[model samples]
Target: MNEHITEIVIFTALFLLVSGMGFVAARWRRADNLASLNEWGLGGRNFGSWITWFLVGGDLYTAYTFVAVPALLFGAGATGFFAVPYTVITYPLVMLVLIRLWSVSHVHGLVTPADFVRVRFGSPTLALLVAITGIVATMPYIALQLIGIEAVLKTMGVTGDLPLIIAFAILAAYTYQSGLRAPALIAFVKDILIYIVILVAVIYIPARLGGFGSIFDAADAKFAKTPAPGDGTLLNANNQLQYITLALGSAMALFLYPHSVTGVLASRSRDVIKRNMSALPAYSLLLGLIALLGYMAIAAGITPIGTDVNTVVPQLFDQMFPDWFTGVAFAAIGIGALVPAAIMSIAAANLFTRNIYKEYLRRDATDAQEARVSKLTSLVVKVGAVLCILLIDPQFSIDLQLIGGVIILQTLPSVALGLFTRWFHRVGLIAGWTAGMTAGMVLLYNIANPANNHAHFGGSAFPLSKLGFDTPMTVYAGFLALIVNLAVAALATVLARRLGSSEGVDGTSPRDYTADAGDPEVKDDLEVAGST
Candidate 1:
């Protein structure tokens, strides 16, 4: 424990500094009033290119990217690196869909994707479905951030649940006080520390352990001895299908997460969205480097200290880096967790307040009331996430995120495709969402991990044979579930139209999908609330 003092001190200092920034973030770019959802939930939606870049970067490439990605690589091998290509393709996909979402959302004064769904299809029930999906999907993700922080704490000789409680309490307090601005402000510090630590580790660690070839050779040797399927330095015939589908499915699912959409919507304009999409792939490159650290860990002969493989990277830092640098690296991982966790809680809070609380609980809620409820909801969400980490296994949190992608991908037809075309009837989309979510959950439940004593809710790999296929092919449950969703949505659309089901009035015009920041319909404040 005495040996951990350096890390504890450095990590605590940085944590306090960021905590202070989180509080001060309330005034970072002060608006006239913080009483509205627009101001409290989205930082007034006026952030420029640089702030958006860091904010979105910090939101997307989370502790999952840092801790879980490398840990997956450490434990399984090549499958973990799927995050690389997934992130690579994510920007292009976002470019295609998100700009239109931003425009439509801006003109409609939408604070959540559910708001866009409500306006686009004019179905409050369907919007409620979208909102619930966002909230449920985000909860596990926020829990994963805590897992990341816990990995750091464990490495620093910290034990027990008390530290996690305190850390999340602080996180919840600042997030309630500052709202979206808290994460937006702290994202700068989080990214800087991450960039520095990752750059140093990528360059220094590889050079220290012979070279890239040696690292690959070491990982290959380690995995070759393991009897587990898909545990190898390279993909094989059996797992290759799972690899492709997982990457593709993850790319499609990434931006569908409400927090990702929140980051996109917070941009000042469509141009900012496009420019950031173009620029965000730089983090993908960084992610690729970070993934390689798994191989570096293998080459350095580092083993995880306990049953949790997520500690591989933190232990790797403690083993490889100097004491002070290990502390810095630990701080990077810890603070990295905070930025995304804050954003996700805020995003989920906005969904509940706007779509659920406002629509059902209190239709007459004023802006101040909405903001107040959202702040409290954000606190509850954070506490829920903390409880998730403490109650469930961390590995389960990671797998739940995989399930989250599956659940959220079901929203693609309503949120992403609905941005461009309104061909699918709202009822059909609702039917699709239900079918997809149910099928995905059923499939996830059936895929068990006997080794982990999990009779159900094991992992994301679902067998294709379950779909009446003869061959031994496996695929990502999310992708297969999404196909089911789209097919059902299409078939239902045809039947609904033939049966003369009402398609609901579109509350938006085509020009609304092309509006910019200064457009008359774009509501920046109460004065322009009449325009919406």
Candidate 2:
């Protein structure tokens, strides 16, 4: 602790500086009043391309990403590169869909994806399912961010849960006061620091490790010595399937997450979303660099502090850089956590306030009432996230996000697909959600990581051998569950139609999907609906 004084001082100074910025963010955008879901949850829904870029970039490329992706690469070798491909696959695939989401959300004043589900499907029950799934899925995600901070702190010899608690306390305070604006404002600083650290690490650390060629040679030699399956510079047949499915599954689930939807909905218009989708892939380039840090760690021989592989990168920084720059790197990781955690909490809270609280608890809830409830609920969501870190104690931190992807992927048929087609009935959608969620849990339960010495919920890779296949192929549990979800949904829909079941009326029209703010059609559509 005494020896780490310089790192601690630099880390603490930057952390406090961001916290101060968080408190000051309520004034940055200068909203008239944040006592509504539109204002508080969506940052007044008027962010231009640049603000949206930083906010959405900060929201998606999170601290857990900073810590965990590298950790995965360090431990598992080339399979960890899945994160880079998945991120690359996501933006182009989800771009058009997101533009529609942005337009519909803008036209309807929707706050959460579940809110869109309710409008699109006209079923409170389905929306309730979506809301609860989002909140539950997002909780562990928020916990992962806290774990990211914990990883850095532990490397710096700062122990106990006290610092984490205090840090989130500060996060909760400003997020409470300023809502989405707090994260939106702080994201500029967060991304800048992350870029600086990543650029420096990729450049300076590789130089110190002799060069890129030496780093790769060292990593190759190290993996060759151990020579376990899936533990080298190249992929094997067994792990290749897992890598592909994980990448594709994760890509589909990325934009469907509540926080991701929150960021999209915060945009002022469809063109902003379209422009952002084309531009956001730049972060994927950053992610590719971030993953290389793992090999750099292997080359530098930077062992993690304990059994936690997440600490390897931080330890690498401490070993390679001066204490002062290492402190800057730690600050990057810490502040990175705050931005996304705040967004996730706010998103989960908005889901509760709009879909659950308003739909179930208070039908006549005002915009102000909804805003107040969401603010309070965000605090509760953060508390739940804290409890997840303390209690659930996942062996591998990446599981937090994968578990979430599996859970939220259940909503794909209703939330993501329902945006384009209403062919699936609400009942079928409900059945699909139930079946997918159940299968996801059961699959997750059967996964056993012998290395981590955990019996259940070990990871997302479901071995085909478990299904009595002779091969060593494995698939992402979430992707498999999504298949089950879609199959059941389609079969049930056909059955429901044959039985003369009533498909609930969609409150939204096709025009709604194309209506953007300030458009001529948007004004008239809002007038007809009396929502905006």
Candidate 3:
């Protein structure tokens, strides 16, 4: 136990540092009212470029990525590298959609995508469905962050669940006190530590074990001996199509997540968001390095303790590094969990208050009431996420996360495409979301994991055979569902237009898209001006 004291001390200091920042973040900009959704949930919508960059970075790349990506490489051989290409593709995809989302969100004073969906589609039921999906999807994700900290604890042979409860209590307290700013401020430290740790691991680990070539040779030799039929190399003929579809689909769905947009929407200007999207791909380079840790684990001959892929990175660190350095690495992962978990809880809480509670339960809710509801909802979200970790197994929650992606992707037709045009009709968007959601869930439910006794997976891609094809080609369940979503929307739009159905008014303007860093019109205007 003494061997692990260094790691414990370092991580404790880091957690305290984050807590200190959480207490001070409310005063960082000194707003007159921190009791409003805009102030507490959106960080005053005043984050400049540098803070946005760090916040978004830390938000997108969680400890799940830090731990799971490497663990994937260790467990699945070449399949782990899918994260690299997916991260690479994400920025370009967001560039196509996020500018428009920012414009619409800013103009409408929207806190959640579901809020935009309700206004754009003129359907509260559809919006509520989207809201529920966002909450369900986000809950497990918050819990998954705890897995990073748990990995560190397990590595130090710290048994029992008491430590996890303590860590989450700290996270919940600060998140309640500081709101989005807590996470944004904490992100600076988390990203800095992650960059340092990954750089050191990529450099020092290979040097100690051998060069990159030697490490790969060792990994290759180990895998060659085992020779699993579907493993080795980054691609295989059997699963090539599945890989591409999953990667591309994930890239498109990445920013569709409410938490993801929550970070971007908090920015001070369109330029801040655009510039961040352009520069954010640089983090992909780091992600590639992190994923290679899986290969490093193979070379180190370290088998993960259980079926929990998230634990792989920490386990590797414990085996490879000295107790002190392991502590630093553990601190990095533990801090990594806190930043995103804070933001996710806030985002989920905002969705509940703005789209659910305020919309249906209290239409006349004031800004202070909205803030109070959201604050309480955020606490509920954290508690729910904790329950997810305690009750549901990690593997199950991970599967549910894929389901979350599919569910969020259904919002794209309403949120992303709705930004550019409204010809699709409000009712059409609703129909598309419903059909797409149903198809995606059904397909995912039918996909079986052979290794796990052919049990259906929440993360599994739909086989082409189910769609009336007999080829080896496969597609992501979300992408396929999106295709159905678009088709349904297009068809419904034509029908709605032919029947002279109400198309509803968009509350944003063309000029809104062009508004940038220093525009005065970007501020709140009472009269709504827009175009078709």
Candidate whose lDDT is highest = 1
**TM-score of candidate 3 against the unseen true structure:** 0.95
Give the per-residue lDDT of model 3 (tens digit) for 1-532. 3777887888788778877888788788767767788888988888889999999999999998888888767766777687888988888778778877777667667778887777776778767877887887788888888878787787777877788888888788878877898999889888888888889999998987888898888877776777466567556776777688778878877888878989988898777887898788878999999988888887777777766656778888887878777778888889889988999999999989988887789988888888888888888888887878777776777788778878888888877787677678877878888899898888888888676564676355577877688776666788888899999989998998999998766556777655664466566422211110
Ranking of predictions according to TM-score: 1, 2, 3
* TM-score-best of 1 and 3: 1
Clashing residue pairs, candidate 3?
Answer: 7-327, 74-294
By summed lDDT, which 10 consecutive residues of candidate 1 come out lowest? 523-532
lDDT of 1 by residue, 127-208 (tens): 9999999999999999999888888998888999999899999999999999899999999999999999999998898888
Write candidate 2's Cα lDDT for 88-181 as tens digits.
Answer: 8898877867778877776676778888899898899999999999987888888899989999999899998899899999999999999999
TM-score between candidate 2 and the true structure: 0.97
Sorted by lDDT, highest first, which candidate order results? Answer: 1, 2, 3
Evaluate residue 285 in candidate 3 and report its C-alpha lDDT on the 0 to 100 scale. Answer: 91
Q: Provide the RMSD of all predictions against the true structure, rounded to 1 decimal.
A: 1.5, 1.9, 2.8
Question: Candidate 3: lDDT of 317?
Answer: 84
Residue range with the least summed lDDT across 10 consecutive positions in model 3: 523-532
